[model samples]
Target: MTPDDDELTFGVEEEFFLVDAAGELVPRGPEVVDGTTERDGELQRELISSQVETATPVCRTSAALLDGLTSLRDDLARGAAARGLRLLASGTPVLPGSGHEITRKPRYHRMAEQFGAIARSSATCGCHVHVGVADRETAVRVSNHTRAWLPVLLAITANSPIDGGTVTGYRSWRHVLWSRWPSAGPPPMFVSLEHYENSVAAMLRSGAMMDRAMLYWDVRLSDKQPTLEFRIGDVAASAEEATLAAVLIRGLVRLALRDVAADRAPVSTPDEVLRANLWRAARDGLGGSCLHPESGELVPIWTVVDELVANLREPLGASGDLDFALDVLSRLRSTGGGADRQLAAYRRRERLTDVVDEQCV
Candidate 1:
């Protein structure tokens, strides 16, 4: 990879739920989003009135990413507090509530009307990381190379272990819930850019997807930007965790770009195997086993994580993020990541409120 490739800009978009003091979701997304002023990013409304989303400015360094995320989160938290609600970063709500209201946007209204229950029930939160690429063709080719690593990333960032006041048993219950959408899940391996566009055309013609924006695959070429967006993981429970995910994703993308330049063929893991591993990652997180991306054998999750990090060592080091990435990984290993931390908090008093209380900060 060229020096320029190592400096590809990236940005992160995080979605959060607004909750009252009792740990119940509240329909205050518009109030919180409008009330907050972002210094280096943008805060906007999500599909549900109970959710708010943040998009950081294009960032060229890990430090900038951390600052943007911290600033935006603080703004949202303060705004939510002013309205007597808390900005929660968990992937799913911890306590059961009546239901969430759809946002007032015309598009959202149509989604609610057309998608019905699926749209109404999708009050989930997730972290989407966007990395700059040369063009749509590059994004499609890089996506092929990066497909195997998506599940490994999900295993690391699984934070939605509880939903509706009960332990849902899956580390990322949001992933399972998100799969209800007809166009959601891992993207099919494409042979070329034309192949990718044809697939999208077919999905639209078949009514599986309403538009390009509904391409809810784990990784997809952005419809609005010249970048590849990774939508695999749940929204991380903290800024550090989110930053770790971004740096790791950028490294993977950089490595993929190099492979593309060299004309190296992408790994051809079977589509069924990719979907199965995704489910396994969402279920276990970092606590149990996952299928190795290369060998397709069930192994300790950390083993797969280590192998991924090792594979990206060169790209990460080239980008001057190796030390920071290692430090974050070390902390995650010690604290057991977001899902583990939330589980620990709940087990302390067997109170789901504790999980909400701990993650909100």
Candidate 2:
């Protein structure tokens, strides 16, 4: 990929649940990942043995991102099949076993030791998008501005309606589960990069988390990279959906940076209100209402979604992702997103296995 001053690059990381031929969750992450290394560090183990994660290479455009994601999914599927398992991209496993097996990594063991049952119950998968920036200050500034829009992002990508063999009554049950962690959720606006770093350091000093990497806010500056990462989305049901989420997030970052450069103050929503907005989004998805950050009035989720896209229109067009964003948003509005489709499947067949199987394809 050639450099373009106007264009910012991004990457996607997706986590998947591994299941057997019978559509039962399988603790086979180690078995499947023991000798596999197509993307080396990009493909990694998660806390739970039933989960595997794959990261796309840095992509300069939406098309490149879609291509990389497609290849990664196919490669992972093929590898899992050879190991007598199937990879399901849904956020929560439909038939997760009651007992959990922790991966034998030191960090994972420590997490299990600390969080116990909560750690064991986390069989959720998600899509994390990282947008590259010029420097840490820019990343921090962009992240601060992006917080208000995160609920809309969650509503659009909600896919975890069912968990542990029962419907959780929340479109993004994964979000609900992850929120139990003290550090997870929308972060507070940072006054500066120093302030952000200091806040994380304080958390670390308090043993809230083992390290900076554990600061799992909905949007955060990357601890190890010069990028802003969005961790609000579930692992999308398809490669196209994943690509769409990544592009919109990159658009958000680009637009936020532009606002920052203009010396504009970011629109702020109080943390209490933001948390409530997140819960509403997770509960209803596009089927419900979302709080408009500006008005603080509840509006149709579709209206909020469209407004978000409109807000990023200029930046998206500048980054060559406007068309893709519009197309995906249109499709989502028309056919509904993963949670809608998953619920439809369950409603049609009245079976959780059917829902899981539908997502596997």
Candidate 3:
């Protein structure tokens, strides 16, 4: 790895759905990314016939991250309008059944053939936040301590409360849906990178996993990228919300690394409660209190969030990122998460699509 690879960095990838006029999901990929379809090539890539992915190049600062996201979404939206398509954000669109496969790429084809129905019907969108580390050791340390706090992050970014036209009664039904795969779910916190790699290697050897990416843990080190990728967080409605979650994650990592260096203990929850809290965060987001991922006690979600924000302030202050960190938390608390916005929109329009539409815009 080069010197550039040694520094910590952050980036994000988001997936979105393609819909057409009359509020219906459309399977139009060949026409979308071919450049002949009049679609903005910047933010849009044909994930399937009816889906696209938006990504921000690696960014070290909030302003740069925000710039990438803004350019991607805004340009994509304008392009969607020109093509008479509407962009919708949700883990999965509320529509039912069979979709199109416009991308004929071999990898996507193989994945579709392997997963079958769920793969073909998948309409999920998500915000994948990637944070860089010095090496595998730091990645493992960060990943281990990050386990207890994954639910907290999930709770705050629970934007996909609706799925298949219903509430789905989960903050991120996308997690539930994705977990069906043989290789997806939370990861165990190993004490070291060697342990982490060994565990994954064992799983791969068992024929249960296709590769490291298939591990599907809420937190995992990317095989392709030298970053600890946070696979939690429902894709947020606005770029601002995503920016908040991304920065907050960086703060947690920086703090966690400091603690680990000082011989502080790792935070881990019991498996049972961890599972339960994951469900609660999925079901309630911040509106309902989340069971403590570690202690199994009921904690007001926002209060816990506030305290976490406080806990990291010192280390973050030392780095001069405390202000942005606190500002993001304040916005999340005051403006509400994706779930909060969805419910509020539903109340106003008495419909879920309206909520989703508002989110994509």
Candidate 4:
């Protein structure tokens, strides 16, 4: 592992949908990306023409992360408005049109051609947290160590309940849609770097994925960056929520690295157990049971989250993130995840436009 000062850094990537004056999905990604004033390569056009993405510079502190994320979000939103569209942070469009206009990029076009219907029908947006690692071996260890808790993170960040103009009955309908991809979800335990590389190479050779970047494991070693990319949760509704997710993820990675230094193997769970837990998280968010990572027993979601907070309290505090994490988790628990808020809006107005408007605001 590369030796350095005790500081660790992370970055955030968020994907959003574009909406028109009526809060309906609009295919204006090209316009927004072209016309955005602050074009520092932070803003990007995504797969769907109605979707856009933003990434933050690497940040060392939670406060910096929040500030950077908010600034980028505001700048990107303003750029969208200039194109006569609103930037929406929702995971799935409540009223997406029949057409799935693919972005005019060669890689995306090739993906659309190769994957056919799955590529065309997918418009799910998500938030990715990239936590820096010392090396590839460390990245593998951290990923294995952190896989069990991803479902808890998903429950906390559930933001897509409605998709295709219907309440899909899951808190994160985006997760369900994304799971249709060939290489999306929790990865199996990788005992060594050799095993990890070989597995990914085999997948590439099988044509299951186009390249290393398309590995799409919920958590994997990023090919282009020296970090572990966490692709577990939906795009958060607010900047604070996105930063909160990043903070918690950083804390988890720190804890995992500590375990690795102590020569401890990551707590292992069966693939079936992990998949079941992920499904439960998507279905119920914080409103139902969560599988206990240590015992393989079902417990109330609050219990699982509380235990996670307790376990990471010291690491978060040491990095000056504990207070912010506590505040965010408390508010999240009280108000429920974004999906709950969307449902509440839908119940009050009986209109998907209102739901979209609430998300945009």
Candidate 5:
């Protein structure tokens, strides 16, 4: 049986960069990962030596999710500090780094060998929120329903404005860098479960991806769990920002499940337009405009955010996250989201280290 909206469990996976006090990316991910105990969630190594990842335990309530993320972040921060390093949650590195080093894992080594430069330069960090679903078929259908909102979510959590010691002029430079992979970016509007599987098979056969695990669409069915994973947003600047993204994603998934149950067709946004909207979101973040998901008309980014909250009001309320979500949204509005805050810090001191310092927490 399908679970009730309030009963749908979700988990968040966040990737972080390890940097020295001067904000330079450092190859200390292994030390930090080994030192940090996974009390609330698992700590894992990433493709690059300077990055580590955390996955929260499945949580059924917004409060529980917040607590799990907060605890995990605290633990990871302490571990980094113990080794004279700091944990940074930004999507891209703020200051210049020595170079990328592929993790010693065999799978990571194989990826670097096969994909060459694409795999070598891909050290971007992102936040993935997995919302429980009944099955893979349901996950596929829900992905179609959830794809249109990805651009808005990306704009909300844009934190990687600086890259290689200079502002990239794009809000989410990580997204642009991440898109270089053949399997990355927004997933197509799948017609059915079979269609999704066939597409994956074709990509593997054509060498576009090495395996099913490389289906790095912004939204996809999880291969390791029974959930629909939303992989659009950056690793947010704080636990609260990360929690806000997870809550909003859960709301989106809940609403999609309702639409599926009602036999409502998912929005069939044109592929070209969807990709363009994503680029716009990455370029402007929340300070500029985005194309309305349905209307295709350019509107202030906050207008799209308002529409998103309005559409998810019932589901968010059913899941007991409406008030908390609203409060976070209000705070984001006042502080101007992650990218805005990062830019503000840089502009104040004209130092990328200041940007790094402000986000160290």
Candidate 6:
């Protein structure tokens, strides 16, 4: 694609866990992924004996995304249901004392040894949104711009508010769990592709990452693709919610691209302010203030959200998903964001089973 390409494409990768009807975690049996042949006798990317992942083919527009994701999710659910398996989308382990067996593959085993104890204990699932970028400059701008919005995505999609089968008193405990890796936290602003590459090279040199793809920033250029990938969101409970996220990412990329075209800097803010708002968002979600990315002031999250929607109003309207985006916001507002729902489930039923059940539902 040329640098001026306006065509925005998308790919979604959802990591999931295989659960039972009784809402319990089942350790994936050995050769789980290898044995996961389709009923017709071929495996799509939906492999793993117990756990599985689904990737929608790269799509040209948001409308195509809805069709693709809905089809993939529905088919995967149907196939799993027929096999007496329940699929749950979340980050981190939800069942206490459940042993999450890592797939015994050379690559996975290598990752386990490379990341050490956290990798051994890590059972985190994330919803990665891949938005195609035309070049490195736009990719860098998108990465930096997307970094400031990371907390928003995290807050909204924080499905695993309770971690390790226990209430963590925060909405997205997976952030903390995911942060346990040495190089895994968030990213500083990368002003250019050279900067991002240098950081990744440094990480590799320091034994922090095996490769560039392991730079676990909220957003970054995919070493393997021509896209800026957002990896901050928890795997959502449903396809509708997942599409909402993808819509926002697509809009965000358009906005960033415009900013770069005009030589406009990202609405700048301090590192500490970003971190503070991030922690606050992790604790309270959309209900509290998100520090102004440029001002470092405690601004209401909804206020920021409204401003973002306004900035992308034209693109969002053009995509014809404005109504769906508004509906998603309404759901978050009325029923609560992920953290709110998780906490409420625990409070009403006094059990983590209720929380996990909500996850599978």
User: Model 6: which ten-residue window has the lowest total lDDT?
Assistant: 39-48
Please, what is the TM-score per model?
Answer: 0.98, 0.96, 0.89, 0.97, 0.98, 0.90
lDDT for every model? 0.90, 0.85, 0.73, 0.87, 0.90, 0.72
Residue 78's lDDT within candidate 6 is: 63
lDDT of 4 by residue, 1-361 (tens): 3322246889999999888887777888878877776633288888888888888888888888888888888888898877788888889988846536898899999999889988888888999999899599888988899999989999988999999689989999999899988878899899889999999999889888987878888999988788889999999999999998998998899988888888898889888889889999999988878889899898988899899999988888888988998998889889888999999889997899888888993
Name the weakest run of 10 consecutive residues (lDDT summed) in model 3. Answer: 33-42
Q: Which stretches of candidate 6 lie over 4 Å from their true place?
A: 1-6, 29-50
What tens digits encode model 6's per-residue C-alpha lDDT throughout 1-361? 4323456788888777767776666665333333443332122332123456767788777667777777766656566666676667767556676646666567666778777777777776778899888587768876777677777777777777777667777777777777777677567887777887888888899988876656787777787888888888888777777888898888888777777778787866566766667788777677777776556677888877787777778777766767889888888789877667767877897887777777773
RMSD of each: 1.2, 2.0, 3.3, 1.5, 1.0, 3.0
**Candidate 3: pairs in clash:** 49-102, 91-124, 94-165, 171-282
lDDT by residue (84-155, candidate 2, tens digit) is: 888898899888564258988999899888877888888889999998885887777787788999899999
lDDT of 5 by residue, 1-361 (tens): 2635477899999999999878888987987899888677999989899999999999999999999999999999999998898998899988886747998899899999999999989878999999988588888888999898889999999999998787899999999999999999999999889999999999999999988998999998888988888889999998998999998999888888888889899888888899999999999998899999989999999999999999989888998999998999999888898989999999997988899998886
- lDDT (Cα) of model 2: 0.85
**Could you tell me which residue pairs clash in candidate 2?**
none
Scored against the true structure, residue 222 in model 5 reaches a CA lDDT of: 87
- The better candidate by TM-score, 4 or 6, is 4
With candidate 5 superimposed using the best TM-score fit, by how many Å does residue 157's alpha carbon deviate from the native? 0.9
Q: Which digits, one per residue and each the tens of the lDDT, describe model 1 over residues 1-361?
A: 2424667899999999999999899998998899887787999999989999999999999999999999999989988998898988899988999548998999988888888999999989999999988578878889999998888899899999998888988999999999999999998899999999999999899887877899899999998878899999899999988999999999999888888889999998888999999999999999878888888889999998898889989989988998998999888888897999999999999998999999895
